[model samples]
Target: MFLPDAAATALLADALATTQPDLAVVHLHGDLGAGKSTLARAWLRALGVSGPVRSPTYTLVERYPLASGGEALHLDLYRIGDAGELEFLGLDDADARLWLVEWPERGLGALPVPDLEVHLGVEGDGRSCRLAFRGVAGESWLAALDERRRLRMLPEPSP
Candidate 1:
């Protein structure tokens, strides 16, 4: 879909926030300045992640414990030199209910398959977002999102 601005992007992210299940892997795909991080921050914030939501660029991974009782893992593999480096991130030990990963292509065969992939791209003065589902959880999440959007229960995106 075409997101007219950052606020529009945030609205989409918020809608997604309410539809996610207990366990989900989301891959955010986009080039630099494409608003990938903005969408991620908005999604995390909607999930009740208070405080600073810094980009995981340098740190590689950042964990946020949701007040709702689940955890969210935000990972940025932009600087990763090798897929083996992901091993130190200890993905196997991850107990996060939601995983948002950027630069997933860098992790390739090492990363877990994403339940849903949110692909963003620059389009004119705005951004374009495409949602693709992988597993059953993703299908369910998309169904919920469609229902919510269809019901017009979701808040309108800020201009």
Candidate 2:
């Protein structure tokens, strides 16, 4: 499935809000400037976060406390030179948290299995994304996520 830049972000944000406020994770696979960070920001906002959301290309991860409940960690592994570095970031939060990880492949063997995977790409004048569910509980998100995709990947309107 795919989405227009804004709608995709909104869709993802809405989907994240349905995860029951516990530990959830999204592993995003995308190229540079393909709206990965935009989606993260939108999702975080939906989680009731109000602050500057920036890429953690250097810090590896940034934790934001949600007003609704729980914490969300946005992580970017682009600058990471090795997989071993993931251990130092301490991604496992015993208190339960939601993780948004980009360049997930870079961390490979070190990360846990994601409940959902968001794969995006730069397509023409906009962006496209695909969401794959890895667990049964993710079906709700998957359904809503696909509903958004149906429109984005729909036929261009009378162009």
Candidate 3:
């Protein structure tokens, strides 16, 4: 979908926040200024996160406690030199229900296969996003999102 501005990105994030299941892994793909963190922050905010949502660029991963009693892990693997580095991050120990990963390519073998992938790219002054589903969970979430959009009378993006 073509996200014409930050508001558009926030709208997409809101859709994702509402449509997602109890458990999900979402991979955010794009270059440095492609708005991956923006979407993540917006989604977290939409999910009732009231505190600061800092980017995990340095810490590698940041965890948030959700109002629904679940946890969300936002990971940025751009600084990792190897996927094996993930072992030290204690990913296996976390009981997070949602995972939002940036630069997932850097931790391919260490990370879980994403239920959904959001690919973002710069287009003029705005951004473009493409959603790809991996399994049944992802498909269901997309269907829910579509239904929500339809109910809101939002137009579908052109191919």
If both were scored by TM-score, which would come out higher, candidate 1 or candidate 2? Answer: 1
Pairwise lDDT winner, candidates 2 and 3: 3
All candidates' lDDT scores?
A: 0.86, 0.74, 0.89
Model 3 regions more than 4 Å off: 150-159
Query: What lDDT tens digits, residue by residue, belong to model 3 across residues 1-159?
Result: 688788888888888888898999999999999999999999999899988999999999999999998799999999999999999999898988899999999998889999999999998878988889889998888788777772243234455
lDDT of 1 by residue, 1-159 (tens): 778777776777788888887888999999998888898999999899999999999999989999877689999999999889999987788779899999999998998789999899997888877889888888888788787773244333355
User: Pick by TM-score: which candidate is best?
Assistant: 3
- lDDT comparing candidate 3 with the true structure: 0.89
Quote the positional error of residue 92 for candidate 3 in Å. Answer: 0.8
Q: Candidate 2, which segments miss by more than 4 Å at Cα?
A: 19-21, 93-96, 143-159
Weakest ten-residue segment in model 2 by summed lDDT: 150-159
